[model samples]
Target: MTTLYSLYFSLVHAFVGLWLTQIINRRPRLLGTWIAVFCTNVGLILSTAVYEQTGSKSAGVAAVAMVWVYNGAFFLSCSSIFFTAYANPVAMRSIGWKLYRFYTAILVVTGILIYFVIVETRGYTLQKIGELFDGKRVHLWVKSPVDDKESDGPDDGEIRA
Candidate 1:
């Protein structure tokens, strides 16, 4: 539950992304490299927004299918990596294996359960799916104006500016 906090998500995901990118980059598999970078950079942003939203993404059948594949795969893959690090004596000796394994299991299990149980996007954040749909990219980081549907703006009785 504490992991729901904004800073925790940002820090963990950022660090994970960096770690994965570094490790995966050395691997022969380009998919891992791409997925790591994609999940980290774009995934981070989407998770941030979804995590902050009040009205969550609708759990339409399409969205559900997307979550099943993408979210399921991601969390499973991440858990595999996490359990490895936890089970590694060298990594654990340096980073306290017992505590790390406890946290790792908690996180991975929580993520898996949330993905399956939560139908709505409430606390269920597979930011990648949202990013896949809202796939617009602007170079710079400036705010953009929302579109006005009315031709003459709020001047008409329609009252939409």
Candidate 2:
């Protein structure tokens, strides 16, 4: 049963990863970033099933992975609260504008930061990626030179791993 569950988990992640890659390849960077942030929250749901039935070091590793993923889950709950406050009639009386407006401002600011901070890493090989980050801070607006080239990579909808 555990093996079956693991297989299911792997398959789900495979589909999600493929979908994410397609989005990243075809859409705006801000949209891809939002999708990634949303996906991170899904880890909290999967964490409960990570523990192995057998008592082993692998189980401990799974527990650690759960904790790591759990750290990102707070963003999901906070977003939900803000959305609820924005949508509810009674909640709109006092704090709705402040809460939801603040949330929107934060989202916009973070989206800008993510766009500037994250390097679009679609076609670069692992070695090329490492070299880019190896010795210096990458500056904003530095587009990858490989953008025009066709990527024979998984982002083209072919799963590599």
Candidate 3:
């Protein structure tokens, strides 16, 4: 059933992405939160808009498929790197062992990169994410300008119950 396939892929994407996030990032929980927010906006909201705009279910399906395919390819590519490294091993070992070494290396490198290079934008507005690429280098642990203090709620001028 379509519903079943959708559910399956959603779960796969969420869990796999979460697992990979834990492996690759310094703050797994924070990154996981961002991933959830990202998926909801891009996966559900954007796809719905596409379906409405084109009046075709296929367009929406394609959008969802694109997200899944991209993630799947990323995961596979990481594994393939290790696979190739062990293709003609100088030291023989099980394929599982090769994968383990690859993942450990990835974890270590990711941790160093996150600590030194990646900025912490937890609780920040996604709108200012563009500033990350505005030719200004943002280092890890720098304070974000788009903090949650800028409320998205109703203006103070509005009456509250």
- How many clashes does each candidate structure show, in the order listed? 0, 0, 0
The runs of at least 3 residues in candidate 2 whose Cα sits more than 4 Å from the true structure, single-residue gaps closed, are 1-20, 26-94, 135-161
| lDDT ranking, best first | 3, 2, 1
What is the alpha-carbon lDDT for the whole of candidate 1?
A: 0.40
For model 3, which pairs clash?
none
Error of 2 at 37 (Å): 12
Query: Model 3 over residues 4-76: C-alpha lDDT tens digits?
Result: 7755655665667556654664355434433433443344445545665776778678656754553443342
Q: Against the correct fold, how does model 3 do in TM-score? A: 0.27
In what order do the candidates fall by TM-score, top score first? 2, 3, 1
Total backbone clashes of model 2? Answer: 0
lDDT, each prediction: 0.40, 0.46, 0.47
**lDDT tens per residue, model 1, 59-158:** 2333334323343334423422455434656654665324333544555555555445433322323343353346542122223356633243223212
TM-score of each: 0.20, 0.33, 0.27
Off by more than 4 A, model 3 = 1-98, 122-127, 135-161
Q: Candidate 2 or 3, higher lDDT?
A: 3
